[model samples]
Target: MAAPTPRALRRGEISFKLDERTAHSSLDLFKKDTSVIYRIVGIDPTKVPQNIERFTDWAVVLGDTAVSSGRHYWEVTVKRSHQFRIGVADLDISREGCIGVDNHSWVFAYAHRMWSAMLANKTTPISNIGHPERVGVLLDYDSKKLSLVDVSKLELIHSIPAEFQGPVVPAFALWDGELLTHSGLDVPKKLSGN
Candidate 1:
């Protein structure tokens, strides 16, 4: 399917910040908690207090807000990162393992110079068209669909259909770069049927 224009995606944009409590120890969040980067010299695990809500093993973080209904859109600017996963996950998704390897999360990943959509340990390779500096995500809750877009090229990377059990939050995992999120945008005119 053709991807909507970036202007159209702005219609459904939402505002959210990363939830520090949900971030992994190796991730450092800044820019009002809307950006995250993986730190080579992570905070000593022993110095950080234990929190069951924290992502213990993965360099992942979740948005502070959850989407329970309607259509929403957000974008992530990947800066100087070669390996990362961007997607949404259920509130109850496991924090131990990687995001896309479990049933509760779905991701569009860029790693090892390959792009793929992953869920529940299943991967479907996507043809690479260079790399995107920005990724746009569309979550149509009522439609039960999640889509990833190449923001600069205005191309659809992939879309997934699923029966979301409950509210889901913006989820991300980074290995070597930084991510800055953009939200509170209007849904694109094309997507809004205008």
Candidate 2:
């Protein structure tokens, strides 16, 4: 194949062509080098320590397979560099556990679990947050991803994939919904409709 131009580069198409059964596109993060790149046609997307990049900036890889079965193609870029740092395979495509990240990486300021971003490199290694308190999950309608981040930092991270992912999200019509999350372990395992 040819070298990759930005999604907004060549033909105003924010997508690349790939075969799901053969080769797959992906995102590679080099925390040590401070760089992020799309491993597909070999394109660098983020500069080291670009302040705005996070785990969300990286593409969602299903297990060890790179290819995904879907229709759309897009990559994520950090707010600072504006480079397409993470080329997501097919976000809206769901494989298992809501497949692609469908919603926001939920956070509660009062219960800051995703605070690994605040660590000084030498002080504490940037590993997944280990919040021991929380409830409710984060859901994405587009990527079909659910992050159990509505309360505590979250733990025992595991992915449960499904052929037909869904309305895995619950509705919170009240402004005080998240506030009550601290009541603990009330997160619904099955999506609302289930």
Candidate 3:
């Protein structure tokens, strides 16, 4: 197969990065492999810290800012050895429960040899993906649409319409063997008419 062409961003595409302070206060629940990468090898019960609460599953982190209106885009590179979930969540999303099991987050996850989008207890399988190495997120708050792109192949993995009740922030979860690399952050382009 031929190499996939890089995708061109539409006007007004905005970007962001992870905010360490707001990254689920329990982020230390997992381990940070590098400055911008993390590994979730499961929390050690015996070593649990006093102030940090233990999560039954998954380690989550959020981006720096809460976006209420705009077209935002960001990309994360996952090593592909294990599963990962990436998307946006309402500012008040719970840090204790599984990310997508609640109403405040919308995430696209890859695990158990499959890709799926989850929102409020619903898991919708997105077929035909084979362990994407990098994922791109395109969030349109005005349209209430969130789309995930397979960056390596330049393919749209899934696009779901969501009701983002308020300001939303970029969030992600990591599992064993997953190394998340924050790829790029785009500045919101000025629109011609706006």
Q: How many clashing pairs per prediction, in order?
A: 15, 15, 0
Give the TM-score (vs. native) of candidate 2: 0.18
Displacement of the residue 182 alpha carbon in candidate 2, Å: 31
Q: Point to the candidate with the largest lDDT.
A: 1
Q: Estimate each model's TM-score.
A: 0.89, 0.18, 0.72
Highest TM-score model number: 1
Please give the CA lDDT of all the candidate structures.
0.82, 0.25, 0.64
Model 1, range 1-194, lDDT digits (tens) per residue? 43221111122456788988888989999999999989988889887767777899889998877787788888999899999999888888887888899889988989988888898989999885557788888888888888887677655668887678888888999999799999887666555541
- Rank candidates by lDDT, best first: 1, 3, 2
Candidate 2 residues 65-120, lDDT tens each? 12222212222112222111011223223332221234311111111233221111
For candidate 3, the clash count comes to 0
Of the two candidates 1 and 2, the one with more favorable lDDT, higher being better, is: 1
- Candidate 2 ranges beyond 4 A from true positions: 1-26, 29-58, 65-111, 114-194
Worst 10 residues of 1 by lDDT: 2-11
Q: Write the per-residue lDDT of candidate 3 for residues 1-194, one digit (tens) a residue.
A: 43222123334544445555434333442233222334344335445542232233446766655677877777766664566688888766665776777889999988898989999989999987777767778787888988887666555668878998988877777654544545345622431111
